[model samples]
Target chain A: MYLRGYVSSREFFEYNPPQKIQNLAIRDYCSSNKFNYLLSATEYSMKNSYLILDEFLKFRDGSDGLAFYSIFQLPLNFTLRQNIFDKILKKRKQLHFSLENLALKNKNDINLIHNLFFIKQSYQKCLSLTDIKQNLKL
Target chain B: MLNSTVLSKNFLSDGYLKIRPKNQKYLFEIQKIITNKISKTKLSKKNQISFLNNFHKFQNPSNLNDTRLKIYNYINSKSIFSKMYYEIVKEYLDILVGNELVMQNKINLSIQLPNDKSSILPMHSDTWSGDSPFEIVVWIPLVNCFKTKSMFILNPKESKHFYINYKKNSKKHDSKSLFNLYKSKFKWIDIKFGEVLIFNQCLPHGNVENITSETRWSLNCRFKSLFSPYGTKKIGEFFKPINIKPASVIGFNYNDPLAE
Candidate 1:
């Protein structure tokens, strides 16, 4: 019960529900339950979901986490979700391997830490999912 | 990507370039055409400059618009006018804008008489409206323009800084306020009869009321790369391809056989 909110729509339904079904379910759940609390929680989670690759990988790995969780909470179109899923999966593996090697080689470099922080902030502002969807529509 | 480094640097830094027209004959021809249309009589070459400079004396302020429109229509109706206009700035335009270009269909004529508040253009970038940033304007003055009779442009560096801070600054400042704030930073262009000024229309530029004694007579036209990204102005409506390379013509007409 405590981890139900963190479950991906795929695992929660035990079937690959179509995008329409997932969208309808999420909309219905929010309207019927504590709508304000759910909206705030979703907004907070979305603002901090900067590492899209990490989030996508965690969803794939079946992690019951809520700080930065599944894309299922947002009612994204089918093609957009599929496109984002493919891209994030590929980038996740590449970024993780490269960053891990760099961290091991330069453990005490303050410049690397500063660069990482800057990159993270820039990515957060640029890669917001709502913004991405709007751009895609345009 | 430009072949001339100095030209590129000067253009990028100053946001404008004023140079002597490549052919003075074509400029004179254009001036003759304009003078003929405006005066409705054969004016000698010696008096052409004086006549254009003192244009306000010929007509009342109320009839200025009608006279301007009539002259504009008469000049543009002649097929030789656009060709002559293009010839005046062909070299500079080839260096600044690309050789393959889309020229504006109708050239714009501006007649600013002394203390005419109705003819003032507010300070704003063409991009703020529907114009693409890739476009450049060729301004040709029929008479010597100086002091308040000339237009002003914000330098590229300061223009960039203003753009970056636009969201925060625009909340409190309107166009007039912004113009006042950056008045000292603007560069007033001084051009003569035999010269042409090509400027980046993406920068903030406009003119105040002509406070000088002489009237200002100028013609402006826009040109852009034939294949560059277009904003609100579509190809056939506002612009038309003036120079198309042979290869581009072939490519445009090529059709894939598999589609059928």
Candidate 2:
């Protein structure tokens, strides 16, 4: 539904999607085991459904979600997505958990909320996902 | 992940993208032309700072001096520049800011002398204002940068620590010592005269002193996202980065060409 306006993945099925991105996104979904949206995202035609796929995937979970921003914004790639996703998931969790509970914060708790604080003061210096994985040896 | 079309996803994953473009001659020529311009000048420490401040004042809004921003008009007329260079750079720009990205600035070159190298830029990320994350930084080192010369660091992995490790939480010490740390960690660029080093300016990057016998001449032209603010005029007309965004113009003036 999110990609309805933008051409979904189905449109490009019969023919080669126009942009270099289409081939990549389509192939990416084909390779992954959990790409249910890929069929929906690509409308078997050139529909620019990837943008909505990106928005939808962000709300979704696991690597498929990470793959959206990574593949589409290759230069941005997936590295920055860790922070972006962790924040999204943490917020989602909070919303769900708040219906039942809440969690405490600490110095060691520098995952999503912790990274969130650093967003304002020194956002420019914000590291991409690759840098963190490299530095922390993740 | 193993797509045939993917020509090394490493570049995308790494924030500091290092590409050896097929055509490098234009960069070399641009450096030579800039070197000639430098040789003709006295190149004083004060002059370097004044030039930086002048460029800054022309675009910065806090001051009343948004006048005479003529660097753009000057570069547009340069005989040494080729249309191809513009095309390639513009293509790269589109990659950074999308196909619709506009020219935020023309081009501004700086020859950082030993004396004034320590001032002005204080390890701030290119995103000090509202720089597009997708935007690309085309660093044309007009001068040779090496270990002894003005080289830099990519921090591909540790780069994410930029906001956290260095800015938000890093301890402060003497300015000289901190710069020394920056120098020590820096990977001196063994670049030829024309090689363009493309990186996300969001990555912590800067140059050391021009320890070499020659000077470190460089043109740092910052571009903005397509829909990003450009105040009232076209940014390319300024030839300098619109730091802090217009309205808070960080030293761009169009009415007065020599206001600087």
Q: Is model 1 an incorrect, acceptable, medium or high docking prediction?
A: incorrect
Candidate 1 residue lDDT tens string, B1-260? 33467877898999998888658998888889989877867888878999998988877998889889988878867768888888788777788888988787678999999999989999989988989778999999999998789999999999998899889889999988988989999999988999999899999999999999999999999998776666676454466566767776455445559954
**Which 10-residue window of candidate 1 chain B scores lowest in summed lDDT?**
B247-256
lDDT of 2 by residue, B210-234 (tens): 4444445556555555334333232
Q: What ranges in model 1 sit over 4 Å off?
A: A1-138, B1-3
Q: Model 1 captures what fraction of native contacts?
A: 0.00
Question: Candidate 1, overall lDDT?
Answer: 0.66
Q: What is each candidate's DockQ, to 2 decimals?
A: 0.01, 0.01
iRMSD, per candidate, in listed order? 20.2, 18.3
Task: Compute the lDDT of residue B185 as modeled in candidate 2.
Answer: 51
CAPRI accuracy category, model 2: incorrect
